[model samples]
Target: MTAIAPALVPLLVTLPLLGAAIALIAGRHRRVQITVSVATLTVVCAIAATLLTVVDLGDQAIAVSVGGWPIPFGIVLYVDRLAALLVMVSSVVLLAVLLFSVGQGAVDNDDDTPVSIFHPSYLILAAGIFNAFIAGDLFNLYVGFEILLVASYVLITLGSTESRIRTGVVYIVVSLVSSILFLSAIAVIYGALGTVNIVQISQRMGDLDQDTQLVMHLLLLLAFAIKAAVFPLSFWLPDSYPTAPAPVTAVFAGLLTKVGVYAIIRTETELFLFNDVNVLLMVAAMATMIVGVLGAVAQAELKRILSFTLVSHIGYMLFGLAIATPAAIGATIYYMVHHIVVQTTLFLAVGLVERRAGSTSILRVKGLMKAAPLIAVLYFIPAVNLGGLPPFSGFIGKFALFDAAAEEGDPLMIALIVAGVVTSLLTLYALMRAWNLSFWREEDDSAETEARISYLGDAPAASVSTERRVIPRIMTSATVGMVGLTVALTVFAGPLYDICARIGGALLEPVTIGQLEQEHEQSTGGDDKGEER
Candidate 1:
């Protein structure tokens, strides 16, 4: 809570990057590479968690002006309760993925899995996410974006197998175009307002005509929309995400797009101010929910279906922002965190499913109950949670969100709320269909057993029978870990929800964000106030 405590922001972002550099240089020494990378992330998470605690102590935002200079001139690292909370949540998620990615008995690298640069690439990706969450300026955030984008490029293409490479190409092109759009948006904001600091832009945007502000705001939202995979701009998601390795795809589904949502939340509440964009954002949220779930229903592949669900869930976050009330946004925060874990765990479970079934295509995979009952449980928990089952965090989060909306008394919001319920139901039905087909039937090895290889399971040893079994340790382990996290979320629901409320409060009124901008402007003494460079 003290000045010294808040300064951990830079180190949190920098340390993992430092380790990533070490990994890239010493990649051949796999042991050292993994050790350094994991240590760095562990420390980063610790610092971030500490910061979150300090923020909970009500010290407001913890900001350190880098280089000992004030905001605008030197980079500022700001950690609000919201940023700190996300940093912590994301850190845990990424860490879990790291555990599964780097630990022994994970990944089939020795056999057929190629391009497993799980060490260097994963660390850098975590670093970028940290930087993005805490960055105090738009350009600083841009740097974070690039860092993650580049790392993701590597992660997606790792092993460079033909299919992986193909997915990587789609990812690269879409990402490049999004980056360009982001840069252009930033340029426009900088050119129009003479400042790239998000807080300053928010403060000054009111000076411009409403039309100009609208255009600029829409452009900025456009960039995040693309990244977040909102409908119409979401074509890139399903094409590329489901094709990557399961761990990579799980992390992407869980973290990458959510980062974009985080950005939009920051922009709407702190920069462009979504106060007046209610109608548009509300409509967009409804459309995103409907379209996304529709796509999910139509998908035949396990990962692809989850990917569609990922896009559909983005709508919930947007709904919170659109509603812009403390209660609604608070619930949105809870929803965001809940969805991240649920989605990530579900995707990881699918990985387990793929291991046991030898395929991810729903049509090709069947009889998981007969072939691997553990995979059935692995698949079911998250599916049930996603359906908003009670005793799970998903229900708590959605209940809060709906409660907030119901109090609004707007017929439109009421309708949107109905749409949300329908979406959740349809999502459940979709998952159920897949579950029934995969887990209910027998190993129709009423044909050939070897012909039905369990690609989703670990390579079998001579001792492990190739028969239909209800439990697989590896599959069970992944499912248990996931279920454990969800249960923790449920048990700690009050405290976690409290943290989210604080985050919503801090984000809604970003005074520290403003202070940083003011500090920057005073440090620069307005010599560079010209609109254009």
Candidate 2:
């Protein structure tokens, strides 16, 4: 059982790859596509849970070398508690999206159902995430990123609608460019250390002058900042994500940028463990949050507003990262788990709303209370939760973050706390404003929109539901999935906090980081001695 944890990491990546292949072969077959997708994700979830169990039993991170090569030679895969937890959270949301997609009848005829392409692409993305999470080396991380980007390009451009394409061009260009930057940084890292293994790199970095280390750190950060859609570098996100298909957007909202943040957190702990690097992270966090919410307030569309909020909330995580305390980092990790599920849920719900109401633009769509009561409740719960209202996961996550900041003396950190509160308030206002237009107010129905809508041989779900029930059953289920996650994060704060604490100890102490490097050296030294003998 203990030995299995390391092997399980590769299985997590492989299952998604297998599913993507099946999805590709069965593109026109909705039943096959959905079945393969759901089953693959389900298995991934199980594997992640098991990995978590392994971590609970011991502090040792599961490690395996591909092609029987040790670290710094062949590719290496490893999973600590941090990676396992993220995988678990991701699997849950992926399952929910799969369920919601099935419920929506998004796939019908083999020809009409693009789910074939979606399945393979989605799987590829998941596989990339698994690889990145477990990757023990820099080059391996790059492989993971390329796979994710390739898949994301397809998903973002799925259905190939005019708007999606237009936005996708910007998205594709920005993403590709970011990838190139990341590649360049990796090359530099390789050149600098003569090895691209993360543990080895950390050891090499410690030998370098502070300025050299700073340069490397900054370069790596620039790459992640682009992925994170942090301020100034984030203009491309709000433009592209909202126009993509619902599931694509939902996955993007929940997974893509967060990957960047994960990388930042990992690098910060491994490399820059000494100084208050949280200051830099803090500045970025504050900028990302304030700008994100402001953009949300200005947006007149539903999906777009959510997109801004998605970017904005990234700040809170950064805030915690910036503080660099165990409590702060733990809160950051917890917040990420909460955010991924809730955001995905909200995106799916909004997509359903857009289809039912004939538009995502708030100016064009209206009256959720009158339109779909279940959906109204769905939007309301996440919308308010996103605002970080008490009892919601968002609130719990933020509360942990701010509490950590309170322990610090930096005025900048203090300001981050205040900004976090303000952002939450404004986030609420923007969500509520959109809510007012889309679900509460009445609006004129357009014939063009109606013609594009397929009622599945019946009237729209929105046309029938009364205020008592709110949202449709399918949409309601999707909403429930998201709200349930939010509640779980809120309620499970104790254990979750503990997991985060352990991860922080791992990161801050970097004993694991040290152990991996020393072990690599000892292995190499033994080989040298054997050859000498």
Candidate 3:
């Protein structure tokens, strides 16, 4: 089983790329494209699940050197508890969103997302995400980002309407700037250390002067901060995300920024464990939380509100990361997983609300609780979960984070805790307000609704009405499946959090190049022995 596990590492990436090629070729046949994409991600999910189980039960990281090359000279794919869990969770999210998109396309006559182009690009994006999670070298990680950038530009601009096109351009330019910074950092690292292999860099990072180390560190952080949508660097996200198709926005909200967070995790924990940036990061976390939620509060449109909250919640993860303790890191991982699931589910629910109502503007839409109770329930579950209400995964994750921060006993940590709590309350208020306006208020109570809207002064320009569309059962099913998964996060929190705690402990203890090389030899030698037998 161990010997075979090494072989499966590459398939996590290769299968999706192969499926993408097939999906592209079969684009003319919509059914074929759908089958290929779904089957591919389903299989990827199974593989990732197997890997997560293997890595967890074995209690060790798995490393594969591609094409039989030696470690430090080859592209290595590494999966420990963190990477495997993320890949598994990501595959599940990708598959669910794919189904939701399929349903949307079917009902919309493939106008919003043309299956021929969408399927291929979506699979490619999946490949990029999986690759980023498992990447063992800086260069390889950069490649993953580039692949995501290319595929996302295509996905985000589907239908090429003026708004999408404009947003896509902004997304592309921001992404390219970050990529350039990342590439430049890689070059500098390679120049200083003679290699881009992550393990080797960690082993050698201490040899550099403190100033040089700080320079490299800041460059990497700046680049990743932009990707992760950390404050001041997060300006592009709220504007960029809401313009895409529902599936595109959902997946982007759920997975893309998390990839950036993942990179920051690797950078801080693996490469520069002793850095002094925690204070800087904590300040940014506070600002991101306060600023993002404030933006959400001001937005009149549901999508835009979700978009800003998306940015706000990112700060929570950053807060945990800035705390830089094992418990905090564990909480961060749990929160990240929680956010990915809950955020995507919320977006999917909003998509349903949009279909049932004519607009996502709470001012224009009304009485969904009476009109479409299922959509109301669907949106409510994840919305409150995101708002950090108790008994849900959001609350559990936030409590764990706050508990960890309190243990630190630092004033800044306390301030961040206060910011996080305030952010949570505001998130609840904003979402529930939307719910009240869109779902609770009677449609005929226009006078009352308008009276309420008058308090906003000028925020109702985006509240224009449009024709409502029919809601598809598959779309609802997809959302229900995601909501169930979100609930499972709380149901299974004990074991899942045990895993995350173990990952946090393991991540702090960086594996060296020597350890990785020896493991590679042992696995390959065992495979040879099996062949001989």
Candidate 4:
């Protein structure tokens, strides 16, 4: 099992890239494109699950050197428990979102997500995400980011609508700026330490002067902070996400920023384990939580409101990172998985709402309770779950995070706990408010609804009503599956969280290049002895 796991690491990335190529070539055959994309992700999902089991049972990480190159010189793909788990969850999300897009395309005749362009780009995006998760070095991670940027640019600008193109431009520019900063940091690190390999860099980072180390740390943090949509760096997200198609929006909200957060976790725990930036991160987390939810409360459109909440919930993850403890880190992982699924489910449900009604504006859409009870139910479950209601995965994750922080008993940790609770309440208010106005009230009561929410003050001007479309069964099925997965996070929280706790503990224990080399030798020597027998 140990021998085989390393070989599977590269396939996690290559299979998706191969599928994207095949999908692109089969442009004229929509069924062929769909089959290849679906099969690829399903297989990747299986591989990730296998790796997760292998790593967990063996209690060792698998690091593969691409092209058989030695450590610190070749491209390395590392699959520890965290990488494997995220890949598996991300693949599940990717597959579900693809099905949702397929249903939308069938119903709308590819008007929103041109099938030929969407399939290949979507697969490429999957490849990028998987690559980033497993990448064992900084340069490889940057390549993953670039791959995401290119594919997402195409996906976001699909249909070439003016609003999409405008948003895509802002997204592209922001992404490019972040990339440049990341690249610059890589250059500085490579120059200083003479290596960009993560384990090797971690081993060497302590050798640098305090000033140099601080500079390098902040550069990488700034780059990833922008990507994770951390406060003061998150302004672009709310404007950029809502303009994309539903599947595009859902996947972007679910997976993209989490990738950034994952990078930050790696940066903080693996690369600069001893860095004293926790205070700075805690302050940022507080601001991110409060400011982001404030933005959400001010929004009248469902998509924009959800986008702001997405940014708000990110602070919870940052708060965990700021705590810099193993338990906090473990809880952050759980919260990340929770937020990804629940947030994506909410967006997909809103997609259904948009199709059922002509608009997503709370003031404009009404009577969904009787008109579309299914959509109402679909929207309500994830809304409250995201709001951090009890027994839901969202609440479980937040409680775990708070419990971890309480162990520290620091004043800032306590303050962040308060901010997090307040943020959760505000998130619920924003989502349920939209729910009540959009679903419970009658169309004839629009005047009353407006009168009641008039304190929000004319923000509905940004919302535009379009012709109502038929809701597709497959889209709803995909969303229902996601919601079920969210519930499963709660039902099976015990075992799954144990795995995350172990991962968190393992993450803080730094591994050196020597350790990887030793493992490589042992595996090769064992294989040779078996061949002789």
Candidate 5:
């Protein structure tokens, strides 16, 4: 079992792609599509969970080389605790979102059903996400990004509606520019190091001049920052995401930017273990937090508001990464897990709100608390949780981050800590404001505005109970399931944090950073000795 564990790693990436092909072939039959998608994700999730347990318990990394080639020569899929844990959590989110989409598709009329293209593209997107999490080399990571981008382009503009087209154009342009920057960085790194393997690059990074190192670092970071939607570079996110379908927006808001954050974590802790740019990263983190929350405050739309807060909360992760201590990095990992679940849940719930209330824009929708109590509960739990209320995963994650930062005990770190607090308070204020307008306040005729609505079958509700019954069981159940996962994060904080702390401690070790390089050299040396014999 132990010897075969590493070989099982590729199944996480391959199963989803296989599922995508089958989903494409079966798209004409909704039942077939649903069955394939759910089964594929369930199996992938199990595989990811098993990988995480094996890696964590074994206290070792799993590296699978394709075509029987040794490290640096063939494509590799590597899974350490961090990568495996991320893949597992991501698979959970992917599964939940897929279920939510299936529910949405089920209730719609034949004419109202989502295009047949959604399933294949959605599964392909899952494959890309899984690939990125386990990618062992820089070039493979780039391939993962490309795969997802192509799928996202289709998902984002599913209807080919005027608004989606306009927004998709902007999104593709921004993504292309970022991709170009990433490709150029890869070229530079390859020119310098002769290999794009992450471990090899980390080992050889020291040999480069300071100027070359900084240039390579900044170029790669610029690309990732755009993808991560870091402030200044992040202006593209709020606009681009809101126009996509609810599930599309939910996954994009929750998972895509974090992939960029994941890259930044890898770059800082693993590749540049000895050399870091904490000051610059801290400044970016501060700005991302403050600016993102303020933007959330200004939005009158639920989706747009969540989108901004999504950007803001990313700063917390950056804060942990910038501190770079074991505790700080550990908190960062925990925070990522919290934020992904909560953010995705909020979006899923809001999607239901749009279905029942006739809009996501707070100015147009009203009285959901009375009209759809279940929907209200769905939104309220995540809303408060996201606002950093006590006894919730969000608060636990934030408190851990603040505690980690305080230990650093520097004035700059202290100031960022204060900013984090303010951001938390303001995030609560913004979410509550939207909640009050959308769910609590009575519908005022004078305040009403044009709403972008995509309600299924039913006309606008005449009473609270009527709207309550309108919600599909599957959609509500999926949202509730995600909310439960968020609760689990708080409930399981001890063991989860221990895992994150172990990962952080390992990342901080210089020897751990060069594990791949050391393995490569030892293997090569052994091969040469055998050849001589």
Candidate 6:
């Protein structure tokens, strides 16, 4: 079990930032931009994968001090087993989305898309996501969120259509509100503890009065909850997400909200340590599961349905986090990975469906199973996996989570568990409905049916018609690659769950702040002696 070099830490962020700059400079040359973006992310993925292996082999958390300052004063990039695994998965998803976007751009011939701005902004977005995963301090995490928000705002509104602009406004406004709350919480925490370093704060948070701690806890959780789109705060997601281009929607659905979930995980396990808010989180989890899936059931469009289901699945993650047990947290980790891949694959496949059928509305699209069997397979695999069908990662993850919850044997836990099962069933129902309408059902050719009137008594067209559009091979291939990763998750569920369980256990173990401080001092002392000599 060898340790990864700390030198690789800053590169995880700096490389993407550098790639963004190069991509911006090469904006006029789309091929150049694509080359640079792909190359940069490829390197990042390699580093992240290596780091994950190292951490999973029992290496301790790898910390890098930016520009050689000591711990409390300097920015740190920390990669433990959990952070490393997230970075690896995120990079893989980013790369796949980039390829999908590039392919879509090439096929569309750039009329409706802003190829230049998209490349650089996408890279910057990836940088922010990676930064968030490895940040070792509260302030740094906030920075990560701001970086992502800026890039996402650009990416979400890339097409500059009227609907996209409107939804982008909603997305940005919600993000700004969340950011403001997060910054305020950071300021108050710094004022109280005098340090925003996570370990330092973890060491001193117990000293705060219970009332103050509760205030801080609620403040942080409130902000993350909004970001995670849990239940009551989730109305914005379904509306904002479904309007974006498919690649944009896919990445946003897969990664952005999970960043919020990651923050909540850090807060509960690292910062607050399972405080009295478990009941609140549990209630929110149950409501999120039920309400989100119900919304999915009512939607007539594929992306909207997926968007609502996205909100629903966040409940499953919250369910595990609320439990706060090692097994529960491990299950949460597994589910997070599964959701990121399956959701992205589903959305990407939906993009293909839209390309083939001219629209994503279930009412408009029909007979895709007969028209595009490969795309149907691509969509079905992820759809069922997301619905927690057996012999898939989704099923494996949900089973682990339910087992953990039932072990608690509390009334609330039992209730949430039941909600979870119902949500899973409803998710499958909603998705299968879309599948049947958009793929299985045949359009009618009868003259009477063709001349059907509008509900408002307006005359209809002689017959409803659909023209299947060209789906680029590269676009389909990229989607297939993502779906393959989802299948791989199921195939390798055993080892992945083991890794997640170890990470969860490690997260619950307390850190010795004094020992960390001593190590920082010793390292700095060594640097000073070397300079003196």
| lDDT values, one for every candidate | 0.76, 0.78, 0.91, 0.91, 0.83, 0.86
TM-score for each candidate, following the candidate numbering: 0.88, 0.89, 0.98, 0.97, 0.92, 0.94
Which 10 consecutive residues of model 1 have the lowest summed lDDT?
Answer: 460-469
Task: List model 6 lDDT by residue over 182-260, tens digit each.
Answer: 9999999999999998888888998998899999999999999999999899989998987787889999999999999
Q: Which is better, 3 or 4, measured by lDDT?
A: 3
- lDDT score, candidate 2, position 259: 87
Which lDDT tens digits does candidate 4 get at residues 494-524?
A: 9989998998898889998877765555544
The parts of candidate 5 lying over 4 Å away from their true place are: 110-115, 444-469, 510-514, 517-533
lDDT of 3 at 326: 95
Candidate with the larger TM-score of 2 and 4: 4
Candidate 4 — what's its lDDT?
0.91
**How far is each candidate from the true structure, as Cα RMSD in Å?**
6.1, 6.1, 2.1, 2.2, 4.9, 3.6
Please provide, for model 3 over 451-513, each residue's C-alpha lDDT reduced to its tens digit, 9 standing for 90 to 100: 867655466335545568887889999999999999999899999999999988888998987
TM-score of 6: 0.94
Q: Using TM-score as the measure, what is the rank order of every candidate, best first?
A: 3, 4, 6, 5, 2, 1
TM-score of 4: 0.97
Q: Taking the tens digit of each residue's C-alpha lDDT, what string does model 5 give over 299-381?
A: 76788889899999999998999999999998899889889899999999998998897677776678788888888888888
Please list the residue runs of candidate 1 whose C-alpha ends up more than 4 Å from where it truly belongs after superposition.
1-3, 103-107, 110-116, 444-479, 512-514, 517-533
* Model 4 misplacement above 4 A: 460-462, 521-533
lDDT of 3 at 495: 96
Clashing pairs in 2: 27-116, 28-110, 278-322, 368-439, 373-470, 373-471, 374-470, 374-471, 375-470, 375-471
Clashes of each: 11, 10, 0, 0, 0, 0
Residue 396 local lDDT, model 1: 90
Rank by lDDT, highest first. 3, 4, 6, 5, 2, 1
